[model samples]
Target: MGVAWPFADRNEGFREGLELALDEINRQGVLGSRIRLIEKDDKSSVTDGLTIAQAFANNSELTAVIGHRSSAVAVPASKVYDHAGLLLLAPSSTAPGLTAAGVDRVFRLIPDDTQIGSTMAAYAHAKRFNNVAIFYANDEYGRGLANAFEDEAKAVGMQTVDRLTDYKDLNDLRRIVAKWKLLGCDAVFVAEVMPDGAKFVSDLRKAGMKVPVIGGDGLDAAALADTAGGAAEDTVVASIFNPFAANEAVRHFVRSYEDKYNEAPRKWAAQGYDSLKLLAYALEQAGSREPSKLAEALKRTKSWQGASGPHSFDGSGDVRDMPIILKQVKDGAFQYLTEGARANE
Candidate 1:
């Protein structure tokens, strides 16, 4: 088995999760043969991810791939895995195009950006933020999320004041904030990964912009507080998993993870564990290493319980009827906004 990420230093939670998951799998003897994981760092580059994925696909020893965290990397890397007839399970990539691309071998543990977008729009409506502005990363993940949010906002009769897209540049973010202010946006929705999202928030604060900022799962990384500093307070985000959850299985996983890593596991870690659990279940049901059989078994997976949540793939190979959670940054930490809290606006 092999696990790939966009970068080595950037995704500590994801890396820790991959290591912990492999250890658990080895201890449980889930595979008849001892499973070994090969880690590859793509440096968050699409070309590098595709290159490594192609190489892995050609390697007969690697049964499947666990990642390529960003949708920017997952989109192209998935094509390589598809060509080689290997399954690629993305732990964090939420770009809707991955599942909708009509690729048979690609699957994701998290809901697509469209789902998150709809949830964000619903939250905006609930909060009565009628005039919304969108800021995106200018990449596959950002652009897709912005587009989804825009569509949903329009559906709910909310007016979109501005749509700003920028590459990984802080100066561009300053320009966008100025534009949003001119457009009279009441709330800002940022759709970008941690790096850019954190920087945008920090810069917005430096510019003395106080409009509420809402983000998708990409902003759930631990670095958000450090990067955004005191400015991160009151920021809202949508997530698929809650590490502070009290579920029995989640508590066990959290305790085990803390004992091993000396820190609370983030959503990425939970996602990695969930992805491996799904893979193991498919392999167990197939009882063979053949790609065709394993893919079929994976599609047939229904109501499988995972550390992240209960997962069931729809006919389109996407997780269906997934729930989304809203959290707010308070005292420099993320707190789950209860149903009533969110409903009460």
Candidate 2:
């Protein structure tokens, strides 16, 4: 297996998640031999990701990969893996375009941007947010999510008051916030990754915009509340995994992860762990490490339970009917939100 990710300060949870799963799988010796993970750091850069993909493709021994957290990287890198006939399992890249090309061997563990963004729009509409502003990064993940939310918002009869990208600095952010205030925006949807997403939340509060803040999985990080401080309070996000889930697998993962890492696993970790678990299942089903067989086995997956949730791939290699839930930042942690009660447990 070839594992690649940026491995940046805030992104280490993803690597930890993969490592934990790798350790468990290797201990079981499921393949009748130890699984050796060939790791690389893509730095979340498209150029670096493509370079790494080509290198991974060159390695004839490598049958599969779990990597490239950013869609900007994964979208392009996936083409390389597809042509090489290697299984590319994306743990976090939610851009629809990642699998839209019908790549034979590419699969995504999480629900695509459309599912996440539409869920947010539905939640916003349920909250009676008549008009909303969108703040997104100028990249594949951001643009895809923003467009999806806008489409759903329009369908829900909620107007998108303003949509802006690439705010250069705090001054620029405040200017955008002022414009949103003038536009009578009642909610803000952020489509950015951590540090950037955290900064936006902090700046939005500094700018004194008290309107609701909603975001996709990009903002659902352990570092979100830590980086944004009290500003992160009440921020709502669409998340893939609920850490507080009562499922035995979830509870076991949480306990084992905490025991090993001395901390709770984030959504990225759960997805990463699922990627490996699902891949192991594919390997078992195929009974061969051959790339084509593994790809076919993966395509046939249905309701494979993991710490994250049930994963069933569609014809396009996109996870089918993956659960997307609403979570709120409360007391410096993301708690699952109960719809009617609006209560955090």
Candidate 3:
């Protein structure tokens, strides 16, 4: 097995979870012989991701890989993994096109952008945020999710007041805020990843534009509150995993993860653990190490519960009907919002 993703501190929990799962899988003798993990830091760069993909593909010892966190890196790398006949499970990449490419060996553990975006849009509409503004990154993840949200918002009888992309400077963000204010947008949705995403929220609050802010999983990080300060408060984020979930599988994983890492697991961590365990299950079901057989086994999976949630891949290699959790930042932590709780509450 090969693990390739950005090794930034922001994703350290993911590494911890992956290592913990690897330890458990090997200890349990899931594959008869011990399975080894070769890890590569893609640095969240497209060039580095492609390099890791090619290197992993060239290795005859590696039959499977949990690869790339962002779709910008994952989508292109999937082609390389597929051509090499290696099974690739993307733990967090959410661009809809990741599974649209007809790569049989590529599977996504997280729900796609369409599900994530529409979930957020529906939540916004339910909250009476009838007029909203969208600000998204220029990358694939941002563009794909932004489009999905826009479509869903329109369908749900909500109007998108304004849309902005790839703001070149703080001035651009300020301009966007002013325009949104003038347009009477009740909410704002940001679709960029960390640092930039956090920065945007921070800037918006600093500029005194405090309409309700919402985002997809790209903004679902513990660091968001710290980075954005008070600006992150009341911000609703859509995620695949909720640490406070009542599921028995989640409770067990959380206890074990805290025992090992001395901290609560985040969305990425849970998904990483699930990816490895799912692969191990597929290996056992296939009764062979052949990549083709593992791929078939994975597609045949149904109601396989993981630390995050139940996972069953559809024909497109995307997880089917996976639950999306809505969380709000409060007192510098993410708390799962019950259906009865309002976005601000």
**Winner by lDDT:** 3
181-270 per-residue lDDT for model 2 (tens digits): 898999999999888899888988998799989999889876899999999999999888776766788888888899999987878788
Q: Show where candidate 2 strays beyond 4 Å.
A: 8-10, 168-175, 338-345
Regions more than 4 Å wrong, model 3: 168-172, 339-345
Comparing 1 with 2 on lDDT, the higher-scoring candidate is 2
Candidate 1 vs candidate 3: the lDDT winner is 3
Per residue, candidate 1 scores C-alpha lDDT tens digits across 59-172 of: 988778988877888888888888888888887788887887788877778889899888998898888898898888888888888888999999999999987775345566
**Cα lDDT listed for each candidate:** 0.80, 0.87, 0.88
Error of 1 at 70 (Å): 1.6
So what's the TM-score on candidate 3? 0.95
lDDT comparing candidate 2 with the true structure: 0.87
Q: Output the worst ten-in-a-row residue range by lDDT, candidate 3.
A: 336-345
Report the candidate with higher lDDT, 2 versus 3.
3
Ranking by TM-score: 3, 2, 1
Give the Cα-based TM-score of candidate 2 against the true structure. Answer: 0.93
Candidate 3 backbone overlaps, count: 0
The TM-score leader among the candidates is 3
Candidate 1, residue 215: the lDDT equals 90
Each model's backbone clash number: 1, 0, 0
